[model samples]
Target: MATSKFLFGLLLLLILVEMNIIEQPWMPGVEAIDCSGKCNYRCSKSGRPKMCIRACNTCCKRCQCVPSGTSGNKDECTCYANMKTHNGRPKCP
Candidate 1:
């Protein structure tokens, strides 16, 4: 009986450890996207660098950059970087 109880306790401990590993959560945050096309065009025509800056800021807040030359459309921006969770907190890199 004692041996059976010991085995059961060990099994329970193993199960708890597994649960902790599986229950790890993912965190989300702002991601940056490429606004090169829009930025260049607007900056050229309007003579306003601020427009590009604002668009970049907005893109950074909403999306993440993928690999360059992978963008499907000229209008579709790519992410330059990602803001993600590290150690239960959001970090931008």
Candidate 2:
């Protein structure tokens, strides 16, 4: 009975580990995307550089893409384009 319980516990632990592995968004061996560089380019023309970089980074991470050019190309990334501030203003640069 004790041996059976031990085996069952081991099986449960393995199943949980496998589930965690499957649920992860990032996969091993895939190159990490450069969110900082893209966000920098996206926010370059803004008067508020810090604020723009901060917002752009958040949007880039969530959208996994940044619109091309320094400004007014939000249409390139639907997720980035759709994010809004508390007062309904656009979020990304």
Using TM-score as the measure, which candidate wins? 2
**Residues 16-85 of candidate 1: C-alpha lDDT, one tens digit per residue:** 7566643323323432235565344434443456654554445544554322232234234333333334
Which residue pairs in candidate 1 have backbone atoms (N, alpha carbon, C) closer than 3 angstroms, thus clashing? 31-63, 33-79, 34-78, 64-79, 65-79, 65-80
Q: Write the per-residue lDDT of candidate 2 for residues 1-93, one digit (tens) a residue.
A: 999999999888778757765343455544446999988887777899999999989988887888889888777889989999999999878
Q: With candidate 1 superimposed using the best TM-score fit, by how many Å does residue 3's alpha carbon deviate from the native? A: 43
With candidate 2 superimposed using the best TM-score fit, by how many Å does residue 35's alpha carbon deviate from the native? 1.0
Name the lDDT value of residue 34 in candidate 2. 90
Number of colliding residue pairs in each model: 6, 0
**TM-scores for every candidate against the unseen true structure:** 0.25, 0.66
lDDT of model number 2: 0.83
* Candidate 2 residue pairs in backbone clash: none
Q: Which runs in model 1 stand beyond 4 Å of their true positions?
A: 1-46, 66-93
Q: What's the CA error at residue 65 for candidate 1, in Å?
A: 2.2
